[model samples]
Target: MTPRADPLTVEVVELIGTVVARYYEEYEHAAAEHSLTGAQARVLRLLAHEPMPMRRIAASLKCEPSNVTGIVDRLESRGLVERRPDPADRRVKLAAPTEAGRATAQRLRDSLDFAREPLGELSVAERALLKELLQRMLGMTPE
Candidate 1:
């Protein structure tokens, strides 16, 4: 039989879900002003960082390759991103953001300035503590 989560685990999961939902809502609103959906904006942001193979993009987005293809197709249609043959392998396609897409990603990131407000409520010490705790929970490094 499958094991069930304890009450504390369930509560923590619920809290995480709530925070993620709120963050996404804010991002969606900010992104909509630039005529991009949250998923599309996310893809563009990833592309802005570096070119990635379609399979890697799908893995990062936790979606199927087919879904990533559709998202890339829409972005390409908007002239935000383009697909090119990977330099190392002609058979492999890579996604790269255009200048317009990089600009859009920057604008979208600037619009969703959530950290500037509520985070301001915490003192530097408290912010450090919170960051340490959250990083521990996520199995990540604070830096």
Candidate 2:
């Protein structure tokens, strides 16, 4: 004997999956338009805030270290990112976004207007409710 999910639960899960799939499609398109792969764009965006070590980047990206190395290699070749020695630990390498990388990341983010197009149709209150629900689903406190 096995427990079965409620019909409403399944429907909600499917809807969420559909929304995420569409979002990724739009996001990847934006990245491609900027002459960057999704992974490279993701790395540049992550480094926009602060420098991070290669291992930490791998953890954040949820990928193998080797994969991150190749991504970084490509980004570095484009002069989008640069690797520097961690000040505290000479053996560790940190990746920092260059000025060009920041600009490219910003452009990609600005170009991804998929959610904005649909959300624009909602009332302010509806948008607020949607944001609250999304935050709750992500296990984040409403700000």
Candidate 3:
């Protein structure tokens, strides 16, 4: 026998799911304006931040390495990113964004301005409070 999730828990989960879905949808729409798919844009953004192993990217994307292979291939074909053999371990490969990729990511981020309006509604104090609460919920320490 297993206990059922409480109604409140279920509702919260559904709400979170809805919010995430909406967020992604909005992101996709914004990315489309720049002639980029959501996944491609995401890859560029990730690479801009740090070089990562393909396996690590696959794990983070919750997909198989083979699936990530296509994404990498497409980006590489566009000259947006490149894979290089890790100096420490030749067997490992790391993915990094090219200058073009970084520029594109920056442009996309600047164009989206996703939270500009919504965030504008909050005062500085209110924004700080919201940030603190969200960080706690996400199990992150506030800086």
lDDT, candidate 1, 78-117, per-residue tens: 9999999999999999999999999999999888766557
Give lDDT tens digits, candidate 3, residues 23-137.
7887898778867889878877788898888888888878888877888899899888999988889899998888988888898888765466677899999999979987988
In the range 50-134, model 2's lDDT, one tens digit per residue, is 9999888899999999999999999999999999999999899999999998888888888989998999999999999999999
Question: RMSD to native for every prediction?
Answer: 3.2, 2.4, 3.3
Which lDDT values do the candidates have, in the order given? 0.90, 0.90, 0.83
Worst window of 10 by summed lDDT in candidate 1: 1-10
Off by over 4 Å in 1: 1-13
RMSD of 3: 3.3
TM-score of 3: 0.82
